[model samples]
Target chain A: MKPHTLSVLVENRPGVLSRVTGLFSRRGFNIESLAVGTCEEPGMSRITIVVIGDDAKVEQVMTQLHKLIDVIKVSDLSENERVERELALIKVNAEPGTSRAEILQIASIFRALIVDVGSKSVILEVTGDTEKIDALEKLLRQYGVKELVRTGKIGILRGSKSVPGSK
Target chain B: MKPGAKILVESLPREGTEIIFGYPGGVVLPIYDELYDSSLRHILVRHEQAAAHAADGYARASGRVGVCLATSGPGACNLVTGIATAYMDSAPIVAITGQVPTNLLGNDAFQESDITGITMPITKHNYLVKSAADISRVVQEAFYIAGTGRKGPVLIDIPKDVSTGLAEDTPLPEKVTLRGYNPTYKGHKRQIDKAVELIVHAERPLIYAGGGVIASNASAELVSLATLVGIPVTTTLMGIGCIPCDHPLNLGMLGMHGTEYANFAVMESDLLIAIGARFDDRVTGKIDTFAPHAKIVHIDIDPAEIGKNKRIDVPIVGDVKAVLQDMLSGLKKNNAYEPWLKKIKHWKQHHPLRVKDDGRLHPQYIVRALSELVKGEAVIVSEVGQNQMWTAQHFCFHHPRTWITSGGLGTMGYGFPAAMGAHFARPDVPVFDIAGDGSIQMNIQEMSTVAANKIPVKVAILNNMYLGMVRQWQELFFDRRYSFTELPPVDFVKIANAYGIDGMRVDSPDDVVPALKASLDCNGPVVMDFRIEREENVFPMVPAGAAINEMIGGHPRS
Candidate 1:
């Protein structure tokens, strides 16, 4: 099953997030990643969900999401010309020698920021599309990645067309 | 200033609620106190589950939002099954629950439960009202949500403090405006035209209607659509009574335990027009082989239901009544299906519904007797299993809302409480709960509820002294290893009498009619126990996972 990104706009109300996510688990839809935050509107929130399913199954997921009373709109951003990004923090084991310089060069090539530095370890903060993040993480694995965390992918359409109610 | 409890009480009549079924508890005493001084008629029930089922029954019978109330924790938890039943069947009900005080909500206080969290999966929508002022608006919105578009149960949980807390005395909203919850009522023009084209050309078109027809009050439109094109109609269990059982073009209930002719028609049809019915597995046995040759046109209010279980050639999302009306306007009289109708007629004549008569009382015979006495006029509610199937099979319903059963969830104890709710909704008509001995005892405590209120509901127990459906399954599939399916007989008549209700036990075939008549003649609730044949099984059965055409046990003549 291919992963499809869904940009969902919902009311900024208590328990609305659980209502949307609960539907996914109950219906047996596989969610690859999810991100949520308040939108431009005062009482609205935007949630980006990456779900794994075929076209028909994903279509059913969209329809089921619309059934929730708190959901204002659900747009499949995967189909449109869009920009996506994921923020990740990775701490790498860097000795007091060539490993440290090599890690700095790798982070510079990926245009990542060195957010924190210890005597023997350095934490790099990176923001990019999912594929770019995966590529950078793969390069740093040889230096013994110590700890890592990622904010799941969030997406938006490229043009002036915004999800209804998000503006 | 007014208390939230008073506002909650005052909101019911404004929303057209004439009656409610509820049980009192500690946290809800404030609301009950307000109810005591209010004009709303509250019927106290023995169990909270009964209160919810009764509300569901009332909703199904009257085509309005039925209301039920309960206190916190176990009380709210007890309403879960009933709420799920209504949710599965698309019955509109609003359940109000009292909660622990706001401060004690998460502190493991006495009688505290996460009811909203518990019911989130079942309810169409729910609210945990934190403020006293939100009561009126929440109540208005709850009713609106419950009664509109793919109707189902909605819950409102008010903490005890919110109910007793004071709020500004404001007027109830004249109209509810939910930006995210608008439901489409009209069908798309292009979709309607496509459906009409299919109907006009189909050689063997069948109308498969469901409870959506009843929910939309579109039984007349459904009949018109079928008659205008000379197409025959069949129904799911929830779709019973949507078309008159005696209608010449109606093929009766379809799928598992359905009529032989209906299953045959579905198997052979070229076009299947499904209205308001989800393709439940029981209705579409072995989904790949169901309606094998039919190019399906599914019309439902819920967009999610379309293509959920089966592929659709034309999917129309709108209110069933409106879609039918639009399709009718686009069509002319056509007799293209005459040959198809003749084939179905042959099937019906060759394999009519039959039951063996060995001089002992059969459940089907008792149901047929009740059908004859009611004359297609009374509301017949049924519990799950053999009793439900027999009632759906034998009862001749002339109009919609006359047949009520838990079709989706198949909750066993649904009938009696639902029958009481139906009686309250339509007091001018007779209501009967056709229950099995096993299922009736699930909520038998409601006998006291009916007796205390003096509601004249008749209970017909088909006593087989076993969990007859499971036994039939075991007998057919597992070499008759009974495996704890049998129950030690308890005197149901004595139990009925103990509740201060009239009751009788009938064993012989001749006593079936007289016992039914005697129960009908009683002024208060009466329980008539019919000692039916223990080994009787509902025939024309499609074994689970088998194709609809692969049915067994329906002999041509019995």
Candidate 2:
């Protein structure tokens, strides 16, 4: 499968995610992962979509997105010139208090944020690259992880310049 | 000379286009007016999308740049789907769009939008004409970028003001230079030697060819290489005519709907020489498991495609025809695979394509009859549906560029306009479209274009009264929950008659040949609707989510 990243500029309105994602489902090209948030521009939102397809076909997908009325701009960043990250939260079993200290020590090594605590369970949030997040999640699995949620890949161009030849 | 439209017209010949296909709208009136009585000939199409497909069909049929024009905003947007289709298939087309005046571009004025910016990813290159002086040179560069190595579509957006403006004598650029656009043509000698060495040592070797053969006109080299080494050749859908179907060494098509013998041969082979064919997921069931037994030698013009799917033992990056020539020169002719060929022939004989033995008409039988009736000489255009796969599975195309289908994009409504373009290129030869009813309805507007131009294209719509392919899957996997697959039958004969064309519908098997002949005998365009079996599924199907070779055929049931 081809890996494609789409940087979308939207109007930060309600149901915007559904509109953007609905297009992909309608076209049979599914969104493998998606990230949306407020951008530097107020009232504007940036959505990062990592799709799987051939480079040429991915370009076609981006074109299809730009055709949508809500999309302001779409960019496919070069791998070397882009920075990517994601976040994950996991709730693991603490073995009734015996494994709680061990879990905290391991979480400290990975710099995971402890969000919730109980006598038998603890929730930890980890943020990093896909690989780092996966590693931390695997380590937590040994403590009987109960629930897990992950934010997909989000990317932006590193340099202080927009895509060439576009405003 | 006139200002806006006239300058754009002058830019035409410099870009190496003698003709363009398009339709006019209010926004593009200026360009249409200038087109009249000009050196360039613009063939008016009934729909804007046909203009794009016609241009693409022209480019693929004849190895030159194809051109199409349209007005903003719906006319321009109509070209988007077809443009994306060409972009996916890598066809060389220059699409010129007429936009609203510059003042109204950003204000959401009538018939105004940013078309050039919208088409950025779908084109190899694109430009916005801010001034009339840039028109000629930009057109020159658009042609250069499109027809150059790894051909693709390009866009040129002309605001109404620039198209009608004049500024002194304009000069077309002699050459175009792009900082990061370069394609390699020559193969490294080390990789070539390594490939030859593997071929010499392998016991069961197979050659996988793709559309690159047609792109490079490398059929002769392909035939010679297959014959020289005595190896069987299996082709992808786009690679259909690289070798004669009757050639003893041909294994037919290999893919989702490919023949049983072809898929078996690919999986059972020891050394796989993949030339110009990417290991698409559709072609190779699961990437990690595909050709697991074979040592791969991948030869392609695009370097990025080499190791993207399967691990490569020998990656020879070069044009297919050129690389094959170098390999042929270095290797000695050997007929050592006689035993291997005999084994494969036994497999092919035992497990050939089978339809129901009943008297009902089967889609594959129709394709076989059409293939035989045409004597494998005419260009075959196929609509996107089960009919397309049936044609690929049964039709024995003998030459490259003979079979045209929307392979990459699989766009319905592609056959008629594409056949129109193919006939435009080779008028002396016969051209026919194996159309599906659902697909035909998508772009039936082209009937007028066919009739007006007097293009004799014989269209055979496999009228099952439903989306046959999707219905086939729904029958087998989705518990026959036919949602939107069924269509309220429209009288295609009346539809054709309304367009001033002859038409007929055949319900019995005996009428198939006669109906075909009747359509071909008519002086102009004709449509023959064959009311085929509705429940017939494309057999020898590879069950979805299964390995390529673990088909619903010969293998033990899972």
Candidate 3:
């Protein structure tokens, strides 16, 4: 099985998300990650969903997505080379102790930004692929991370390619 | 020049709406008052559910969007099942419900309910109009959406204030533009060419047609394709009218309770041309084993259905009529699949559908008699369960849209009201609702509406005095634990009389035809209650979730 990212363009209407997610769950397809936001056009929203399935399952999910009336278009981004990102905000306990300077140093190495600083804690915002983010989180856990919030994932076709769905 | 109620009433006729089925209450009284004087005729139903079913019936019979109106709260809730019925069956219907008032909506005032919210999952789309100004535009869009590609029900909930408030007169738009809702109507040529190529090369090709054919009015094209290519055709329950039942190439219906030969043909075919059919579970049985040998070609107007249920080797997303027309256009004549036809005919001959004849009346004989007497001229509606299956089995439908019944939802009590609505749509045609004793009583109150409206639709009750299907299941699978399936006999003739309609009760098999003929000859609404064998079961029963070849009680042939 391979990870398939589906880029779905839908009308930004109430309950459209529920309709899409409902189809996924009904067909017993577990979505690994999902991200939804405003698209280039007003009244249209783009949803990027990650699912682990073979060709047969991925094809079925795509076809079912197209069945939804609110869904304008759907494309499987896995077929094309694409750029993907996930953003995480991690609040780590700097404490007055030995690892505070080391935490900032590790953040510098990963190109992470220090969004907030306090005497006891420093919040670092990291943007990267899932693996990079996971690696940074693993390093920061040694410094006693207080809390973490992450957006699942968002993707786009690289260079001159656009999401082609309902036009 | 008029309030929103008047505008709503007038706009219906402009959209070619001739009749509406509804029940009035406090909030919708003003609209009903406007309806009384306007050219739009309204039939007052005993229940809101019947109103929706009647509208669904009208739509299925006439190929137009049917309209139904109901008041707020429970009235709107009652319409839900019927709305869902139409949605599942892909019938085009528009349901209108009145709310208490704009202010009273959140407060839950008298007779107010969130009908739009309640019906969202069941309908194709829904709206809760907050202003009278939007009524005309909303109604226009509602009709357009309801009747378009992959047609289904749409609901519009209006607050009382909106219906009564004055709005600046706005002309109805001749067109509607929804940013999201566009249906593909023409088949892509490349896919059609691929389909034709597959058909040309296949040794044993079969056509599996479904409700989409009827919705697209593509039956003629289906016939041309099958006749031209010499391919055998089998219809799903929804596709019964796609070809005449007696057409030489037509293999009756396919599924559980379907003809044995049809199921065998589907299993044995090499290339299955699925036109507008969704490949429902009942048709497929066990999904993995269904048509295992066939390379499937699925053509539908809605792209969503292409590979949702079954894998399609060739998927063509477009309107059925358009796609079939292209497939038939340069098709070379061929006389292949002779061996396939021979095998199908052998099965048909050996395992023919029949019931043992005793002194008792069989339900099937009544259906057969009705088919013969009507001579394929009348519109037939059926209640769910054995009566529905029997009608599906025995009725020789020779034309499209002549058979209107609940197929997907299988809602009982749907038949009579639907027949009433069908009669209103085609005033000159005879309409009959074949029902079981249990199913008919669910909405028997609609008989009063029929009598009051002077709709001369006939009701033929195959009175078995049980919820026959449930009892059959209990008998076969549950060790004959009858539970509450049996019902104390009620006199349908008396009920019809109380509603001011003439009726009769026939006991013997010999009297079935004469009774049907008498009901047809009657000048007004009539109910012919024919008492059928109490314990009879529908044959060719494939246990649920079993393969198509699996059968329990059926013809005793391999």
On DockQ, the leading prediction is: 1
lDDT of 1: 0.93
**Per-residue lDDT over B1-558 for candidate 3, one digit per residue giving the tens place of the 0 to 100 score:** 557788788778877898999999999998999987887788899999999999999999999999999999999999999999999999999999999888777797888788876786688888888878888898898898899989999998988899998887787656888766778898888988999999998988999999999999999999999998889999999999889999989998888988888888888899999998998998889899899899999999877787878889999989999999888886978888788778888888897788667878999888888899878888999999999999999899999899988988889999999999899877777899999999999899998898998989899999888999999999988999999999999899999999999989999988887888888888799999888899999987888899887876666666
Listing every candidate in turn, what is its Cα RMSD in Å to the true structure after a full C-alpha superposition? 1.6, 10.2, 2.6
Q: Candidate 2's error at B225, in angstroms?
A: 1.2
lDDT of 1 by residue, B1-558 (tens): 788899899988988999999988999999999999898999999999999999999999999999999999999999999999999998999999999999998898899999999999999999999989999999999999999999999999999999999999667667888878989899999999999999988999999999899999999999988988899999999999888999999999999998988998899899999999999999999999999999999999999999999999999999999999999999999877889999999899898999668898889999999899989878999999999999899888998998999999999999999999999888988899999999999999999999999989999999999999999999999999999989889799999999999999999999989999988888899999889999999888999999987889875532
Per-candidate Cα lDDT values, in order, are 0.93, 0.82, 0.89
Better of 1 and 3 by DockQ: 1
lDDT score, residue B334, model 1? 89
What CAPRI-style quality would you assign to candidate 2? Answer: incorrect
Q: Give stretches of model 3 more than 4 Å off.
A: A1-3, A28-34, A51-55, A92-103, A118-120, A136-147, B100-112, B171-173
Model 1 misplacement above 4 A: A95-98, B556-558
i-RMS values of the candidates, in order?
Answer: 3.0, 10.7, 2.6
Superior by TM-score: candidate 2 or candidate 3: 3
What ranges in model 2 sit over 4 Å off? A1-167, B1-4, B173-175, B355-357, B553-558
Per-prediction DockQ? 0.60, 0.04, 0.39
Clashing pairs in 2: B3-B164, B4-B163, B4-B164, B4-B165, B5-B163
lDDT over C-alpha atoms for residue B135 of model 1? 94
